[model samples]
Target: MAKLRTTFVCSNCGYSSPKWSGQCPGCREWNTMNEEVEEKTKVSAVSSVKSKTVFSSVSSVTEISTGDELRYNTGIGELDRVLGGGLVKGSVVLLSGDPGIGKSTLLMQACGTFSRDKTVLYVSGEESAKQLKLRAERLNVNSDKLFVMTETDVESICEYIKVNKPEVVMIDSIQTMNNAEIQSSPGSVTQVRECTNLLLRTGKSLDIPVIIVGHVNKDGAIAGPKVMEHIVDAVLYFEGERNYAYRILRAVKNRYGSTNEIGVFEMGDGGLSEVENPSQALLSERNVNVSGNCISCVMEGSRPILAEVQSLVCTSGYGNSRRMSTGFDFNRLSLILAVLEKRFGYRFSGMDTYLNIVGGLKLDEPAADLPVALALVSGFTDKPVPDDVVAIGEIGLSGEVRSVSRISARISEAARLGFTKCIVPRSCLKQIKTKADIEVIGVRNLHETIANVF
Candidate 1:
C-alpha cells in the first residue's frame, strides 16, 4: 500500500510548503495556506516494449497559414468585438465574475447562437439539467444541437468530449470540477489547476473552442489558484453592479484578441441583450443644465464611449471630511481634490465630496480627469456647466491640462452625440487633421478651462 503525503499550498499563488503557516510566503497573504493530501503510487516494473518517437517540422512565421474559417461567430456582435473577431479554434476562454453578475447567462446565450450550425456541449458541475433547462427556456435558448450534461467528474467529461467531438464545449464552472484521481477537494488549488489543464489539452487536441466559467472570491478576484488563469488562452471578466442593469465584459488576457476591448450588455427578463451604442445607452438619462454633472469621452480599445461624471460637495458635519467615489478610483479622487485645493484654491477641506460615473462604468483613463475636475468645481460653486459642452483632457498636479492620445476620436464621438463645444488639451490641437462639425476649444491650464466652462 502506498502512503499518503500532506502538503500546505497557498490558495492565492499556488506556492507549496511542507508545513502550514499563517501567512503565505509566496504571495504574503494571510490565512491563505491550506493543507492538501496527496496519495503516492507505488512504482511498478517497466515494460520491455519500445516506444515510438514522432517528429514534426517547424514552420516559419510566413509559412504558417491562418484562414478566416478558423473563427466562429458567437452571434453576439459585442461579444465578437471583444473576442477580436470571433472565437478561434482550439482556444480556451475563462470567464469569471461575481455572483449574479450574468456570467452563466452570457455563455448560455452564446450557446444558442453556436448551436445554429454547430454542435455544443455544456457540462455543468453546479446546476442540474432541470435548472439549466429552466434557464434556457427563460432565455429562449432552445436548439436541438445544444446538449447539457450534469457531472462533476472532469476525467469522464473529457473522455466524453474526445469521443463525441462537439464543435464547441462549455464548462459551467471550473471550480466545481473534481478528478477522482486527485486526493484534494474539488475547489482546492491542485484540483482546479489540474482540471483546467485537462480541459485545455482536450480543446487543443480536438481543435475545439472551450469556454469555462469561473467563480470570484470575496475580493472579487477569480477563485482558486492564479495558475489556472495562466493555463487558459484567454481570461475575461464580467463586471457590473447587482443593483444596476448594465454589465461590462472585459478581457484581461487574450492570445488572439486585444485585452483592451470591452463588451457591454444589459440584463433584462429575456436575458442579456447587447448594447449596440453603449455611449447612447449610458447617457440616455442625462439631465441637462444640472450642476455637478459633466460629460467625458473614453476609449475602450479602438471604440470611443462618452460617459458622465457627477460630483457632490457639501459641508461636512463630522470631524473628518468624508470623500467617497463610485465607479471612479478613490485614490484618484483624493489626488484630484488635492490638486483642486492646492492649485485652484477651491476649498474641499471642510466639505464632504462624492463622485460617480454614470452607468456603472469605471473611468480608468486619465482623459477623464478634466471632466471630473469640472464636475467637482460645478458642484462646489453650485453652477451648472453648459449642456452642449464636453471636456476631454488629462489634468496635471501643476494645474495644466495635458495632451491625450486619440483626441480626434474622442472629440468626434462627442460631436456625433450632438455636443456643440469640446474642450481639449492645447498640445493636441495639431493632432486633429480633419475639421469636425463641433467647436473645439483648446486650453493649456485648469484656469483656462474654468474661465471657458464656468
Candidate 2:
C-alpha cells in the first residue's frame, strides 16, 4: 500500500478540504461535507513522460466529418423528436426524472426498438437480472439482440463492454455505480463524476452511444455534481404528474439538436405511447360556455397548442386575501391583476384569486398573459368567454396587447381545431395573410379587448 489518507468533500459541489466544515464554500450549502478515503500513489518520471507522449494534435473544426448518417433512430417518434431526430453515435445522454416517473419504461421501449437491428446492452446496478426480466415481460419487450447484466462495479462493466462490443449501452442509473479506485461510496459526488468520465471515454473510444439514467433530488434537479451534466452531450428531463397519464420530455441541453423541442407521451397499461396530436388530446375534455374559462394558443417549439386558462374570484374570508396559481406563475398573475385594476378598474384586492392551466400543462410564455387576463375578468364578472374564440397576445403594464411571435401558425392551428374567431394584437393582424375562414379580431389594448370580447 502506498499510503492511506482521508479528506472532507462537499457532496453538493465536489469541493475538497483538509478538514470538515459546517458549510460548503463552493456551493454555500450547509452540512454537506463528508469524509472520504483516498490512497495516494506517486507516478514515476518515466510514467509521467509516457502520459505526456499520449497527447494527440488538435484537429480543425472544418476537417471534422458531419452528416445525417451519424444519427440512429430509437424507434420512438416522440423520443426521436426530443432527441433532435435521433441519437448520435459516440454521444452520451443523461435521462432524469422523479422516481417511478416512467424513465425506465421509456428507455426499455427504445431498447426494444434499437435491438431489432443493432446490439444493445442494458446494465442494471439497482435491480437484479430477474427483476429486469419481470419488467421486460410486463412491457412485452421481446428482442433477440438485447442483453441485460446486473453489475455495480463500473470497472467490471467496462470490461464486459470491451469484450462484448455492444453497439449501444445503457446504465440503469449513474448513482448506483461505483469505481474501485474511488474510496467514496456510490452516489457520492466523487464516484458519480469519475464513473461518468470513464463511461464517456468508453463511448467515445468505441464509437457507441451510451444512455445513463439519473435520479432527481427533492428540488427536482438532477442528484449529482453539476459537472455530470456538463460532461454529457444531451440532458433530457421527463416532466408531468405521476398521477396523470401525460408525460413531457424536454431537452435542456443538446449538442446535436435544438433544445426548444419537446416530446409528449401518454402512459398506458401496456407502456408509453406517443401522443401524435397533442393539441386535440389536450382539448378533448373542455367544458363549453363555462365561466372563468378561456382558450389560448401558445407555441411549444415549432408546434402550436391550444390550452384552457381558468380563473376563480371570490370574496376573501380572512383579513388578508389569498392568491394561488397552479400551472401558471403566481407573480405574473399578480402583475396581471394589478394591470387590470389600474387600467380596467377591476377590484381584485378584496377577493381571493385562483388560476389554473388545464390539461396539467404549464404556461410559461408571455403570450399566455392576454388569455389569463381575460379569464380573470370573465371569472370576476361570472361571464363566460365565447366558445368559438381563442386568444393570443402578450399584455404589458400599460394594458396594451403586444404582438406575439408566429401569429400565423397560432391562427392556423386555431382554425384547424375548428375555432371560428381569434383575438390577437392589432400589430399581428397586419402580418396575417391566411385565407382561413376564421375571423381574426385585432385589439390595441385591454380596454378595447374587454369591450369587444365581452
Candidate 3:
C-alpha cells in the first residue's frame, strides 16, 4: 500500500512545497498555496533483473515525411482562420473563458461540422447527457457520428479512447476531471495537472486532436496551474462581455499557427454564428458625425479590422480628475493625455476623461493610438470629426505620428468599408504601393493632424 502524504501547492504556478505559507515562493502570489494529499509508492526490493524497455527511433529532419494530411477542418471559417488553417492532428487545444461566455456553445457548434465525416467523442463533466442533448437540439446540431458521455474519471475516459479511437475528442472542461491515483479532489492543482497530462498522452499516441474546455478564474485567466497552458499545443481565449452579443476568439499560444490571429462571432438563440465581416458588424450601429467618436484600423494576423474609438471628457467635480479606459491600456491613455497637454495644449488635467473601444473589442496594437488621441481631442473640443474618416498611426511621446505595419492592408480595409478618408503617418505614405480609392492624408504630428481633422 502507498503512504498518503500532504503537500502545499501553488494554484497559480503549480509549485509544490512541504510546508504551508502565506505566499507562494514560486509565483510570489499570496493566498494561492493550498494543501493537497498525494500518495507515495514504495519500490520493491526483489529487483535483481533489469526491465526490458522499448526505444523510439530518431529520424533526421530531412528524412521525415511532410506529405501526410495533418489538419482537420472544424467547418467554421473564422475558427479555421484563428487556428492557422485548421486544427492540427495530435494537437491539444485549451479553450478557456468566463462562464456563459459561449465556450461550450462554440465547441458544440463545431461538433456538428466535425461529425459530418469523422467520429467525435464529446465528454462532459459539467453537464449530463440529457442536458447536452437539449442544448445540442437548441443549437440545431444533429449528427449521428457525434457521441456524448457524462464522465469525470480520467483513467476510464483514456481507456475508452484507446478501445474506441475517435477522430476528434472534446472534453467539456479539464477542471472537473479527476484521477483515481491522485488523492486530491477534482479541480485541485494535482488532479487537473495529472488529468491533462493523461489526456495529452492519449491524444498524441493516437494522432487524435483533443479540444479541452477550461474555466477562467476571477482575474479572467485560465483556471488551474499556469503549467496547464504550457502543456497544451494551443491556448485560446474567448473574450467578450456577457451583455454583448459579440465574442472575440484569440489564440495566445499556438504551436502550429500565429498567435496574433483572432476570430469574431455573434451569439444568438441558435448558438454562435461567425461574423464574416467583423468591421461592418462592429461599425453597424456607429453614429455618424458624432463628437468623441473615431474609427481605427488594426490588423489581427493578416485580417484588418476597423473598430470605433469613443471618448468622453467633462469638467471634474472632484479634487482630481478621473481617467478611465475600457478595452485599452490605462498607461497608454495617460501617456496620450500627457502628450496632448504638453504638445497640443489640450487641458485634460482639469477634466475627467473616459475611453472605450466599441464592440467589446480590445485595441492592444499601437496603431489605435492615433484614433484614441483624435477621439479625446474631439471630445474635449466638442467637435465632430468627419463621418467618413478612419485613422491609422501610432502616437509618439513628442506628439509625432509614427508609421505602423501593414499600412496598405489597413487602408484597403478602411476603403472597402466605405470610408472616404484615411489619416496615416506621413512616413507610411511611401509604403502605400497599392493606391486605394479612399483619399489618403498623411500627417507629421499632432499639430498637422488637428489642423486637418478639425
The best candidate in terms of lDDT: 3
lDDT of 3 by residue, 191-289 (tens): 787788889888987889999998876431223536599889999999998899999999999999999999999999999999999999999999987
Lowest lDDT 10-residue stretch of candidate 1: 44-53
Query: Weakest 10 consecutive residues, lDDT, candidate 2?
Result: 218-227
Which candidate gets the maximum TM-score versus the true structure? 3
Ranking by lDDT: 3, 1, 2
How far off is residue 392 in model 3, in Å?
A: 0.9
> Which digits, one per residue and each the tens of the lDDT, describe model 1 over residues 222-319?
24526578888888889998888999999999999899999999999999999989999999999999899999998998989999999999999999
Q: How accurate locally, in lDDT, is each candidate?
A: 0.88, 0.87, 0.90
TM-score of model 2 relative to the true fold?
0.92
Better of 2 and 3 by TM-score: 3
Q: By descending TM-score, how would the candidates be arranged?
A: 3, 1, 2
